[model samples]
Target: MPTGTISKRSVDAANPESKDWLLWDDDLPGFGLKVTPAGGKVYVFQYRLARPGQAERTPARRYTIGKHGKLTPDQARKRAKDLAALVAQGIDPRQQEIDAIAAEDEAARVAAEQARLEGELAFENVAATWLDHYENEKGRRPSSVRQAKLVVNNHLKPRLQGKPMPHISRSDLQPVIDAIPAKQRGMRRSVFAYASILFGWAHKRGDIPDNPLASMVKPQAPKARDRVLDDAELVFVWQASAKLTDPFGPFFRLLILTGQRRSEVAAINWAELDRSTATWTIPADRAKNDVAHIVPLSKPVIAELDQLALAEQIKAEEEKPDGKRWPKSGFALTTTGRTPISGITKAKNALDAAISEAREKQPLPAWRIHDLRRTLATGFQRMGVRFEVTEAVLNHVSGAKSGVAGIYQRHDWHDEKRAALESWAAHIEAIVSKKQKDSKVVPIRAAL
Candidate 1:
């Protein structure tokens, strides 16, 4: 009901809590200007919609059109006109405002995706974003994402993620990569090598300056694992394995049957096994190479798992041991209540401690749990197992040239492979039993 024009100067001077209203000289209705707590003045449009039994004395349902800074008082007047037009058509301004925001959000999302496609962000940056987006946000498997992150974080990002595509000279790359640990040198080389491919991909889209790893000296390192387990240390660990409980006993034994990483075995789930098929399937998400593998279980390995009903009883009792704090679920070494074993370190510490205690009984070679896997691999090779079977047992595809065959044409000869595993397990059992009975054992080095 207010009329005429209110000046900016008058508006600024008026008390914020003033009950009296002022009019703005504009062609549109329901438009107003106000100041925020910061004293920054802005414009807004407020209006009402009619409903059944609406009274004249009822407060006009009000909603904000825009901030004064974003929409000047004049612009707010125009928006008020639009709101009036919508109201005239039986639409509520508040509902229309919400719909507009939703549409804008959808547009913004599409724009962000298009920008990502066009930006040619560095392979390192783009990959990092993708990993963060797909792996962290969308819940892609952790192992796959971690492997990709490791490649970038350890090798690619340090040298190339920030480099302009064109400035990636081999001179800059060679020294950066030659620094990764020798054990992972081949993997290190492949990462930078992959950076070149990503850079080229970015360059084609005008995203990067150039790919730098091109024409660089490739890293030199043997990409094969050939470590063998020692004899004296073997007897000590075998003794300790029996002293542990069922699942840990079976788990510690599983490592000997399978040469996979500690993380891989610890994360073992029921879905990965099929005793009916006599095989274990490691999904690409859980595998180190990001490729699925089929392990042909031998009788002794099968027998070991069968003893625990395929690792069921131990899985059920994960986190209830004396009400101790436990890790999250899904592991080979849990005690009760679906906990991952916190004792990865504790288990290894106990291993070293046991070895220390038995040092007088046997001055064994310094060995790790991984040594058991190596010994099994070495034993199979000595037993005339094919190198392919041995490498496949370790789930490696080192010599494969064809990508399709290397990844796809995998077959698990469970029955045949079981013979080799049984032979190895029996031999270790014989060695273990012999050491248990033999009491002549003493520290080769005499105590001072």
Candidate 2:
């Protein structure tokens, strides 16, 4: 190796036939210019890097600056001096360049990861995952799952769908929570509870840093419902119900006669009925309490089931253009008979209209289908039916047989429940017909 001040003229004048020789600068020990056999001249720096915690020197590393013409001798000398200063301070310039390139690549990776997360963990995406878990994984009933999706899609998603997960705050949710009517306390509570659960789920999964609902207070607690239809209202409902068309009309009558949940009554399957024994078995999955309940069908309930069965038979006989005939779904209250009845809103609206027209009175008090269940229970209690027997008739699992007693006591009160339901059904018939004298027993098979 030769040592001298590296200039353009000196580099160009050097032997073209020389086999890749390096000329080091006399002013700067490690700074040099490499001249190849093809006469290409480039400024370069060579230095031996010291091993950590040792006096031993490793092999020298060569770093290219630029071509001879790109940087003059003065500019090359200045750049080389700066690099030499870095070497004196125990820093490897070559390693520093490699680390800088790696830093740029790491920064790009982080930016890309952030962009992906922004799209994937938005409020709508999290809500979709939550809904899948509720219906598919947790095995919730279809009706309940439908309601949950309604709240999320109609209310939650419209407001928060595109918002970033971390950017969501309690303020973002408070207005939505406040918008739900206080009179519908139970629904408000449920909607808020579902929203809180969604945020909590995202937080637990590391999708969001914190739950916005955690800091926000929940909607007001629901008041206990005690509304039961009086005799006048009961008569009004019964008469109006008869004027209703098939399926919806019969469905409402069953709601009153059976004293079961509206969903349970509306979604009843024909296969659940046993005509000879006059009994309808509600499966565990369909029951609100998740317990398989046996409902002893009275003559009225039996007659209603028979009416639905007869209609289905008639519909099945009706021929289509293809001559395939109408299909029969296992559900009792469906229009198409291929799926369960889904026009609850339309049915209720029609019932309300009929009731108002029949009464000609100052706007009837607002009531839901569930009020019929309460009405039946209250009526049974007034008729001197024992509390336990009435509870069993309603298939309620609480009261005397709740908690440890419920766990230990296995008696189902089958006989008592049957007698109570039969008695209640007979009483409802007498009221609907506006007949007096409890002594006169009303057969449940009478026309509605």
Candidate 3:
């Protein structure tokens, strides 16, 4: 052992010997530099715990401050003075270091647990998981899945995002239900239904302690829509749709001509149509009822399709790079060739505006795009078409063709459906062209 001032020159000059040796600082009693036979030099502080006026002393414990190159001689001396102060105050510096490390580890564990709870219990995350289960596990229809997603993204997520699932209550959700327009009662009911389903699923999966929507009063189902566009309103819509932009104009016209659902009409592939047979085949996978349907293309429908095809070809020609040919097949009603037309709500709003402008009178009563199918069914019935044939045209498996009757009745009513659609198209043409005198009654034979 060497007793001297621990200076930078002295620490640098120290060398390892056959055995470890200590060089004690003159000013600090227990602080020193220890050099090992392996040529390792480290700053150290050795201390024994003792209280004032006590005779008993604890065994000596050495604290390694740092290596020689890592900590300068002056830096090691300052740290040793801190340890000496703790010893005079009857505190054990080594135990304090152990407590600090343990506290840091405990703090890290708590923070990680809080983060896990946040990620697992957030409303957005729970809803995403519920939707995946709803679509895949429950095997819901694509349209149903789409409607649920729309309600979540447009109505629910904006209001409840990031909220803890366990903390959500009915009070947090009532305002979301109240925000929808009063006139949109059906939409309000749909929002409530989707939210209920999501929370219910989360509760069942133990992701939530309880369903927040359980006590909330669900909105009553809206009354069935009986809205049918009158002849003048129908003609107004037809003429107005023509004045609007591409795809939408033709898309709306196809809905009227075919009496098909908006989604089915919008997703029409070019390959689904046969020019020679003048028929459009909606495959089972795409049909809402999961039944393959063959719709006869009336002259007007075929003509409208031809115009759409020509417009698409023109667009392709304009957009294609020089010497590159555009692919001829994709969705029939699409802006991008890869996907079907979307934003129908915006397009419908535009159509409503056009219809309002065209009418210039009492604004047409609130009607959904789905009302077009009802109107077509009503038209077929008024024209004396058989009930079964009308159902076949709309591809409905209810009424005449449901249950045991559906299982046994193999007749597709192909001819009757074709005639009914052709007559309806002619009726629409007559209304649009201003050639028909009375819209109330048309010859029954025309439908048969």
State which candidate has the highest TM-score: 2
The RMSD (Cα, Å) of candidate 1 is 16.8
Residue pairs with backbone overlap in model 2:
none
Give the CA lDDT, 0 to 100, for residue 105 in model 3.
Answer: 100
List CA RMSD, all candidates: 16.8, 6.1, 7.3
Residue range with the least summed lDDT across 10 consecutive positions in model 3: 319-328
Query: Mind giving the per-residue lDDT tens digits that candidate 1 earns over 332-395?
Result: 4557637544465567666666666777644455555666677877766666676666676777
- Looking at model 2, residue 73 earns an lDDT score of 81
Put down candidate 2 lDDT per residue, 75-184, tens digits, no spaces: 98888988888888889999899999999999999898677567786778778988898888554677778878988987788888788777788888887777777787
> What is the TM-score of each predicted model, taking all chains together?
0.51, 0.80, 0.68
Question: Candidate 1 local accuracy as lDDT?
Answer: 0.61
lDDT of 3 by residue, 308-407 (tens): 7767667657653332222336888888878999989999989989988877755688998999999999988888888999899999999989999999
Between which residue pairs do clashes occur in model 3?
none
Candidate 1, residue 73: Cα displacement in angstroms equals 30
Scored by CA lDDT, what does every candidate get?
A: 0.61, 0.80, 0.86
Rank all candidate structures by their TM-score, best first, as comma-separated numbers: 2, 3, 1
